[model samples]
Target: MGFDPYLAYYHSIDYGRASLASDLNPNEGVYLRREALKRYFVEYEGMLNREFIRQETEENTTFQKCFRLQTERLASCIQNTIPYIPFELGI
Candidate 1:
């Protein structure tokens, strides 16, 4: 990764912090799991499996696949010195 983990776009700057991860995180919250890590992983899997319709193509895509596309877009934006367009899960 060419990015500095501490240099964030959305999160506030802090010493020795992984702000870039925060910026990319879709689920931004604290999950104090009573079911250990199992529930966390299960829920995350479910979220990734969830589907959404593409506005331009009118095709369905999983969030996991969308995440890959978004990552590629972000990398392209960085290399080309262009603005990063975030993924939108429309309501």
Candidate 2:
């Protein structure tokens, strides 16, 4: 919505989402950024899932909180990497 940091243009597509463009440096790596986000989110999900399996297991609240913050920042980095120009598809 606002200027995103790891900038990629987002829009609705029949595919469920649309990606229009990006401003990532060749070395900055959108691929790496995407992988990192996926890894962090998966880790968070695993932590919560483990809690369900073992009631009093590590109580991963602290790591989850920290990971949540990291994901937000990483998401921002991905969002702001380019200009998000949107246009209507059926115009």
Candidate 3:
């Protein structure tokens, strides 16, 4: 089965229906997945920057540490989900 990220986000909320997003045509699904991944990486990069600032700041040491840990986990999850077909890929 293929996957369409936008359709999944937009249509999967309804009850008693299979995900139309997952049933997308292969080409469209791949394109949608690529775009979704790109957006995810952008957001992840922003989160990393925010986490870095939090680590550097002195306010809310405990909260900062927690956020850093959460950010790291999120980065790892995103990395794992991405297809590993390219060697020169950048975050």
Candidate 4:
């Protein structure tokens, strides 16, 4: 959390650019109809709550939990100079 959003490892630093935020942005543009949007949200919510075995913790975890875990992991990596492992969604 003490990270400088503009400072990035793979991306070049530039004026008014948030490289970290840009790196986390969705790669695809989302465009959906009303019904499709509803369906998408339903699936998205389901995915957020979906449980899976986390390799690091060896316990079932949801997307929301993984996000929190990854955030903490990143913070630890930054503070302690440990390697940060990115989260992977198998689905």
Instruction: Give the winner by TM-score.
Output: 1
Which of 3 and 4 is ahead in lDDT?
Answer: 4
RMSD of each: 3.8, 15.2, 14.8, 3.7
Q: Flag regions of model 2 displaced more than 4 Å.
A: 1-61, 82-91
Give the winner by lDDT: 2 or 4: 4
Tell how far residue 14 is off in model 4, in angstroms.
9.1
List the global CA lDDT of all models. Answer: 0.81, 0.46, 0.48, 0.83
Model 4 lDDT tens row, 1-91: 5578997777788899888776776365568999999999999999999998987678888988888888899999988999999987655
Residues 31-81 of candidate 3: C-alpha lDDT, one tens digit per residue: 348889999888776654552223334343343455555556545655688
Give the residue spans of candidate 4 off by over 4 A: 1-21, 26-28, 88-91
Instruction: Give the distance in Å from residue 6's predicted Cα in candidate 2 to where it truly belongs.
Output: 19
Predict model 4's lDDT versus the native: 0.83
- Model 4: which residue pairs collide? none
TM-score of candidate 3 against the unseen true structure: 0.25
Give the per-residue lDDT of model 2 (tens digit) for 1-91. Answer: 2333433445323343223322333233445488899998898678644522212343334444544555566556676874433321222
TM-score of every model versus the real structure: 0.63, 0.24, 0.25, 0.60
Q: What is the lDDT of residue 11 in candidate 1?
A: 90
Q: Arrange candidates, best lDDT first.
A: 4, 1, 3, 2
Q: Write the per-residue lDDT of candidate 1 for residues 52-86, one digit (tens) a residue.
A: 79774679988888878887888899789999888
Ranking by TM-score: 1, 4, 3, 2
